[model samples]
Target chain A: MLRTYVDMNLVSGKQPHAWDLGEFYLIDRIRALVPDIDLTDDCAQIELPYEGTLLFTTDAAIRGVHFPEDSKYIADGGFRALAGAVSDINASAGKPLAALLALVIPPELTLSEFDRFLSGLLEYSRHSEVPLVGGNISRGDRFGATISVIGSSNKVVTRSGARPDDLVVLSGSIGGSEIGRMIISGEASDADIKSLDSEIIGTLLYRHLRPLPPLGLGEKLAAIGATSMVDISDGLIADVEHIAEASGVNIHIELGKLPLYPGVTEIAQRHRIEPAILAAESGEEFELIATMSLKDAEELEKLQMPMTVIGRVRSGNGFVDVTLNGEPIPPGFSEGWKHF
Target chain B: MLRTYVDMNLVSGKQPHAWDLGEFYLIDRIRALVPDIDLTDDCAQIELPYEGTLLFTTDAAIRGVHFPEDSKYIADGGFRALAGAVSDINASAGKPLAALLALVIPPELTLSEFDRFLSGLLEYSRHSEVPLVGGNISRGDRFGATISVIGSSNKVVTRSGARPDDLVVLSGSIGGSEIGRMIISGEASDADIKSLDSEIIGTLLYRHLRPLPPLGLGEKLAAIGATSMVDISDGLIADVEHIAEASGVNIHIELGKLPLYPGVTEIAQRHRIEPAILAAESGEEFELIATMSLKDAEELEKLQMPMTVIGRVRSGNGFVDVTLNGEPIPPGFSEGWKHF
Candidate 1:
C-alpha cells in the first residue's frame, strides 16, 4: 500500500534533518497522512457561507527554477506546483476553493522524494476539487512550492475589464511549453520525439507534464461575458500585454489567427526557432486569454467554444499589435518568460 | 526619499539575474511600489461583502531557517514573516483580512536588502490592517517569506474547543524567545546584555525583534468565550500539548503559574538552565494559550486581562499534567522547541 508508505519513509543512508522530524512530529505526520485535512487549528476556517468574491492566488515553484532537478519528470514538479496555483484560480473566473502548500524542502530531499512530492500534490489536489487547506514547511537551499489558490466567485473575472471593441479569445494551443522545455532540457532528443508524430509526442508530453488549465474554459468565459482575463503564464505576446496593460487598451494580434501547437511547426523547425516565434514567445501557456463584447463574442460563437478569435480591443496607448496577412509583424524577434 | 529608492535599486557589482528584472518588470515594479496593492489581475478579488468564516493561514520564513542573515536585525525578517502569518490570524480569533507574500528572493539580495525586506513587510502590513492582497516573487537558494494570512470570523475559535474544567489562560510572558535566540546566536553576549536589567534588555529585545501578537487579546478571548486557543508557538509545554491534543483533554500545568519573560529567572540562571525549564520550554512565545469559562474567567478578571490562570482542563488520555506545589512534577525535563 503506497509502496509500504514509500518504504517506510525512506531517506536511508543517514539523512534525517527536517529538524529530525520534530515540527510536532511533522505535524503529526501531516495529521496521520491528510485525513481529510482539517489541519485541526492555527487557521483554515474557510466556510465562506455564501455571498461571493475571494479568488486569491500566489504561485512560486523554484527547484532549479521551476522544475527539472535531474528530470525523469520529477513528479512533474509536484504537478507544476498545483498546476501553477490552479492557473491563478483558472484565470480569475474562479471556482477551486482551497490550497496552501508553501513547502521549501531540500535537506537532501528523500522520504522517497518527499513521497513523490506528495503524490504530485495529492494529484493536483484531486484534480482541483481543491481542499488542502493550510501550509508552510521550510528547510531550504532549493526545492520550492508556494502555491496558495483559494477561489470563489459571483463574477470575479478581472485583468481590469477590457473595453474598446473587445474580442481577443484563445483558450488553447500555444508553443507546447517550449517543446516540453526542449524535452526536459536534454535539449530536445529522443530522436526529436522519435521524429515526431505520435500525436506530436502526446502533445509535447501533455503540454509539459500536465497543464490543461482552461478550467472549464474559464468558467465558460466567465459565463459568456468575460471582459478581460489572462493566464497564458507569460507568452502569447506576454499574455496579450496583460490584457493591454490591464485594459488601458490596444491589443490587435491576428497573426493568421494563431492557435499553433500542432507540433509547433515541427518543433520550431527542429529548434532553428520561428514558428511565428514559437507562436508568440513560448512560456508555460496555461492558455486562456479572453476579453469579450461583440455580444459576448456572438455568445461564444453560439457555444461551439473550443476558442480562438485571437485579437481585437482598441483605443490605443497600451500597445501590442502584430498582424501578418494584414502585414505589420515586426518586433525584433521572440521574448516572454522572464520571471524575475 | 526612501534613500533614493534604495540607491537606485542597488545590486551593484553587476548582480542582475532575477531573470534580468522581468516578471513584467517585476510586476511593473510591484505596481509602482505597492500603490495600495490591488495588483490588477490573476486572482486577488477579495470582496467578501459580509457573512463570515475565512481565516486561512500559512507562515514559512526560512533564510538560515527563520532569521539572522548577518542580522542587523535583518529587517526583523520582514517583521517575523508578517508576524508569523498574523499569529495564525490571532490564534483564530480572526479579523485581519488579507495578505499573501510567498517571496523567495536571493540573487545576491541587495536592492537595499530588498527595500529592507519591503520595509519589514510594509511594517507588518500597516500593523495588521492586513491588505497586501496577492504575492509570489520567486528565484531561490535562500531568502523566503510565504506569509498568507486572510482572516475573518463571527465566532471561530477551535483547537477543538476544550471542555472539562477549562481555565488554562496565559496571554503574556514565556521564555523571551530563548533569550532572543541566545542574543542572535552569538551565544549570548553583550556581556549577556550588560549583566541584564535594562528592563531585561527591553524584554529580550522585544521578545526577539518584535513579536507582539495577542491581537487584541485574541479578540478578547474570542469575545470572552474561548473554549480553546493556542499561539505560544512551540513552548509552554508545547502549546499546552496543542490544547490537550486538540481538546481530547488533560492539561493540568500549574507549576507556579508561569508568566516568565521579565529576565526569565535571570536568563535561566545565566544559562545554567532551569528557571522552571525556561518557563516550560522557550520557543517563540507569541503568547495566547486560552480555554476559558470560570464565568469567562471571572469576566476576564473584571476586564483587566493581561492574564495568567495557567491551568485546568481535565478528562484524560491526552496527557500534559506537571503540578509542583501539589507535587507530581516529574516529566523527564523540559524539552519543547526543537523545530529541526
Candidate 2:
C-alpha cells in the first residue's frame, strides 16, 4: 500500500527541482477549500465579437516595496494585490472569473504567517465571487505576490477608445488612499493625520489597507456608452496617459474641478503641499476615470457612487494638458506621482 | 503637454505603492511584439461540454530553488517556466490560448539581462504558438516568474477517469533527466557523467535544459481513449499516486519493462545507486504517463513517439505496488523524489 511510501525513513536520492514531498499541492488545496476568485482586458472584443472575448491582466505587490515589511500586513498585502488586479476588469466593464497568485515566501515566514496572507486573498475571492483557482509558490529571500486575472465579456471598454469631445468622469474621490498609506506606515502621526480627525484618518487608512474596487460601476458606464475607461491605480497623469496615448487624443484635467477626499486639503495644507496637485498626483486610489459623451456623463453623475466630471478630451497626438483654475499651473509646480 | 511633466526634476513626495516613472508598460509592449502563450486543468470539461472548457494551471522557476543561482541560467528559467505551464495544457488534451507571467526581478539585474530572460520566454511562445499576452513586474532581491496558462478544449482527459484493468504507459524514457541536471550543475564530473559517451551526455543535458513536452502526443492519446493522463513532472511513483488516489485504483510498474534512457544504468552503476530506483524517482522530466484499455494501448503503441507499456492498473484502494522482474521490489527499496 502507498501508506508505506509515506512512512519510510530511508534516504531518498537528490531532489534537484522538487520541494519536499506533501507540500506540492497542500497550499493550493487549502486555498481552494476557502474560495475562488477572478481578475482581466481584451485579446478581443470589437474584432472578435460574440466569440467570448477573454480579458487578461496582471498586478503585483512586493514587501518592502509595495508595502511595509511588517508580517502583520501580510493579509492586507494579499487583499491589495487582488484589488489591483480585479480593478483592471472593472475598467473593462467585465466580471472577474479567476485569479492566479504567485507568492515568494522568504524563509523567515512561518507556514501560519503565510496562511494569514492567504486569508486576505481567500476573503476577497469569496466576496468577489472570483475563485482562487490555482497559483505557484517558491521560496526566496523576500516576500512578493503577483496575481493574473482572466475575465470574459460580450463587450469591453478599452483605453484606446477615447475620442475628442468626451467628458472625463471619476467614480469616486482621490488622495485619500495615498494619505491612508501614510497613516498606516506611521509617517502621519498624531501631530498631523490623527490630530485632524480620527474618523477621517481611520477612513483613509481603511481605504488604503483593504480597498475594494467599485463592484459594478464599469458595466454601468459601458452600458451608457463610455468611450474609454481606466482604473486609477497610478496617479491621474501616469495612468490617464495610457488612454491619451492609445486614443491619440489630448486630455486636459481641471485641478479645481477635481473631486477629493474630505480631509485631503487639510493634510496637504499641513505638509505645505498644493491640494490640487496632491489630488491629481495621488496613487493607489483604485477608483475609475472614464470618458463618455456629455449626455452619458450627465446620466453617470446622477448615479449613487458620486461620479464627478473632472476633464475633457481634445484633438491632439498623445499628450495631456492641465489647468489649475482657468490658468496654467505655477512653473515650479510639484509634478504628479508617477506610479508606473 | 504631458512632456513637461516627464522632464521636471522636482522630487516626488512619496511613492508607497508605485514603481518609478516611465518604466511602466515598456516590458509588456516589447514582449507583446515577440509573441503570446498558454498554460491549464479543469474548471470544467465533462460536466460542461459543448460550452468550451477552460483549463488552468501555474508553474514557477525561482533562482536558487528550481534552478541554480547563476545569472546565465535566467533565460533557461524562463523557458522552463513556460514549458512547465504549457505541458499542463498538453496533459488535458487541450489547445493553449494565452499565458500570463508574474516576474519578480532582483534589484541588481540590468535591463539588458532582464531582456535576455524575456527573450527566452518569447522564443518559446513563438515556437509553441502560445502568445505571451500580459504580465506584472516588481523589483525584489530574488528573481522569480510564475506563469498561468488558460486553455480551451471540447473534450478533456482527466486523472480520475482510470479504472481497473487499465494499462499504464510512459511516453518516453526517464532517469536521464536527473542525470542531465547533475551534469549541468557540474556535480557529475568527467570522472562520472563525462565518462559516458559524449552524445548521451549532450542528449541528456538537452533533455534537462530545454525539454518541450511531447507536444501533440497527449491529444493523440486522448483521441485513442486514454483513460487517465498526467505529465511526468516528479518521478514515476509520486505522480502516479495522484492518478491512483483520484481514480480509486492501484497502479503497478514493472521495473524490467521501463524504457530506460541510454546510459542511465552506466551512470547509476558509478554511484552504486539502483538503476530501477533512479528511473522511478527522477523529477522534472516532462514526459507523460497515461492509462487506457489494453486494446487502445495496443493502438497507441504504434505512434511515432514510441510509447511503452510499463505498468498496469489493479483493483485496490490507491496503492501502487511495484515489481523488479517477477519479484517484488526489495523491502528497503530506494524511494522516489518528492517534487512538490
Candidate 3:
C-alpha cells in the first residue's frame, strides 16, 4: 500500500527531492488526521476554537548542532528537542495549550524511522498533555526539528523582573546531562561510569536524555511575586547572563553556593576536570532560575522541590560574576552553548 | 568566528551530531532576532493579552505532489504555497494576523538558495500584511513546505449550513489551472498557445501559480442568508460532494453550466481531452463554492464578480450528480489530487 502511494515521479530515481520520502509520508498521514480546512472561503471551519492566553516560543534542533549523527534513538532526540522547546514556555509560568512542530527529516532516514519519530513525538505530546494543534512539516537538507509551543498563563513572570538585592534561586542540581552525554559518546569508560551508584547513574542518564522542565514552579513563583526568572538551558551562569543583559543588571554567583548532583563532583575529580565546567557550562538543565525577595525565597524553600540561593543581583552593567572565597572566578573560552 | 565556534563541540567529523554545532552560536543568533524573549523563565511572555477569536490552519506543498521539480522560480513556488495556505484562512472572511512557516530545506540546496527562499517567503509575507511570527527550520530528505497561519474572523460560515434547494455558486471560472499546468507540461503547441489571448493566459497561469482567493465572498454570501459553502480546492464536483457530505444532502451539478475561461475549450479540444477533466478534476481554484437562496443568487448575479447556479441540493444521502443535456453524468475515476 505504501509502495502504491509513493509517486512514480519520485521512485523512478531522478534523485527524489528532499521531501520525497520520510517527511512526505509523515505529512500525508498527519494531514489525514486533520479535518477539512478552507482558508480561502470565509465559510471554512475548524474542529475547535482557541481560548485563553497564548504563549508562543520557537526552538530549533539542527544536525551537527544539537545532536550527533550516530546518536542513539533519533526518535528520542526529536522528543527531547521538542520537550526542551516546550520547557521554555513552561518556565515562563504558562499552561501549555498546544504545540506546532516543524520537522526536517534527512534523506538518509527511512520511511519507517520517520514514522517512528512521529510516533515518539505523539508519545511525548500525550505525556505532556499538550495537544498537537497545527504545524507544518517540510523537507530540509539535514535532519532538523523546529518546535513552536504555545501556552497560557494568568500572570506572567519575566526575566527582567529581578531587582538589586533579590535572592537568586535554582530548582534542581546540574551536570548530569553533560556527564550522561559524555558516557553516550563512549569517551568515558564503563568502570568510570560504574564507579558511581547504578541508580544515580541511571537517573543522570535519564536526566541527560530528557530534562523535565519545572512546569508549575514558574507560575507558583509568579503568584508569590518572584521578581525575574529564566531557564538554565545554557548552564546556570550563562543563562543568568541572559537575564542580566536583558534586565540591564549584574548577577554575581558564589561558586561554593552552587548546587550539584550526587556524583557530579566525584566524576569531575576523577577526570581531573573542573567541577565548574560540569556545573556552569553544561547545557539542557531545563530548571528555572528566578530572583525573588529574600523573604519569598525563604517561603519557596518550604516547598518539596529543591531551591538554592546560588547568587544575587546588583545594580551594574550586564556582567556575570562567579566568585569563590570572595574572589572572581575566571570564565572559560566557551561560555556554554551559544548557537550564534 | 564560525569556525572557532564549530570547534567548541565534542562531536567532530562526519558523525558530529546537532550538539557539535555549538549550542551557544545558534542561541545567540536566534536570540538576536528575538531580543524581547524571556528565556530565563518557563513559558514565553505574550506581547498582548488574549482577546477576540483566534484562527488557525496548516498547509503542505510537496515537490511532486504540489509542484514540478524543473519549474522556473522555486522561490515563487514557496511563496505560492504560503499564499494558498493563507487564502484558506482568508476564506473565513478573516484578516490574516501572523504565520509560522516551518520550512524543510533539501540537503543539496546551497546556503545562497536558502537565503533566496527566505527572501521569497518574506516578500509574500510583507505583501500579505502578515508578519512571519515564528517557525521551525530543519533539513529534510526532499523539498516540502508546510505553513500554519493564524487569522481573525468576525463571522464564520461553516460547510454544514446548506439547506435543501439552495442554489450552488462559484466565485470564478473553473478549469483554468488545469490548462495552465498542461501548458507548462509541454502538451500545448506554440500556435495553440499563441492563438489564445495573452491576458487570459496570464490569468490562468497566475491562478495556477498564485490564486487570488475570494476572501470576502463567504461573509458577503453569509450576510445575505447564504447557506453552506466551501472553497474549491479539490475539483468542483468533488468539493461540492464534500459540502453535500458535510450538510447531509445530495447535490446535482449542471455540467453545461460551468463557467470557463476564454481559451480553455480550444486547448481542451486540441489536447483531445474532455473539458470535464479540466473543469471537474483540476484543483487549486481557490474560489468560493456556495449554496444560497434564489433571491440572494439573483442579487449576487447583478453585481460584479462571477456567480452561477451550477447546481442545487436535495434531501438525500451525501451523493453528488452531474447533468448534461438532462442526463446524469457519471463520476470520473480521478476525483481529485490525493496525497495517499
Fraction of true contacts retained by every candidate, in order, equals 0.91, 0.34, 0.45
Q: Please say which candidate is ahead in DockQ: 1 or 3.
A: 1
The lDDT for every candidate, in the order shown, is 0.75, 0.71, 0.67
Tens digit of lDDT per residue, candidate 3, span A188-289?
668777788899888877776666777778778877778887887777787888788877888888877767776788778778877765677778878888
Pick by DockQ: 1 or 2, better one: 1
- i-RMS of candidate 2: 10.5
> Candidate 2 lDDT, tens digit per residue, B173-244?
888878777777776778887568888988887677677888777778888888988887767777787788
Return the lDDT, model 2, position A151.
70
TM-score of each: 0.37, 0.87, 0.76
TM-score of chain B of 1: 0.41
In terms of lDDT, which candidate is strongest? Answer: 1
Q: Output the number of the TM-score-best candidate.
A: 2
> Candidate 1, after superposition: displacement of residue B328 in Å?
7.5
Residue lDDT tens for model 2, A1-340? 3224434523353222212323544354354555432111001011112244577777778887776678787788778888878888888877677777777766566544566678887778778887676666666677777777777655677888889999988887888877777667666666886556678877887687778889678778888888888877667766677789878999888889888887888888888887778878787787888899887776764566788888999999877777888887643343445322
- lDDT: worst 10-residue window of model 3 chain B: B14-23
TM-scores for chain B, in order?
0.41, 0.85, 0.81
lDDT of 1 by residue, A1-340 (tens): 4434334556344534443454455555666666677666888877774867788888788767877776355677888888888888888888878887777777676554665776777787788678687676767777777878787877778887888898888866688877877776777787766767787777687687677686666777888899888888777887788778777888888767777887777767877876766777777778888888877787876667578787788987678888766888776454686432
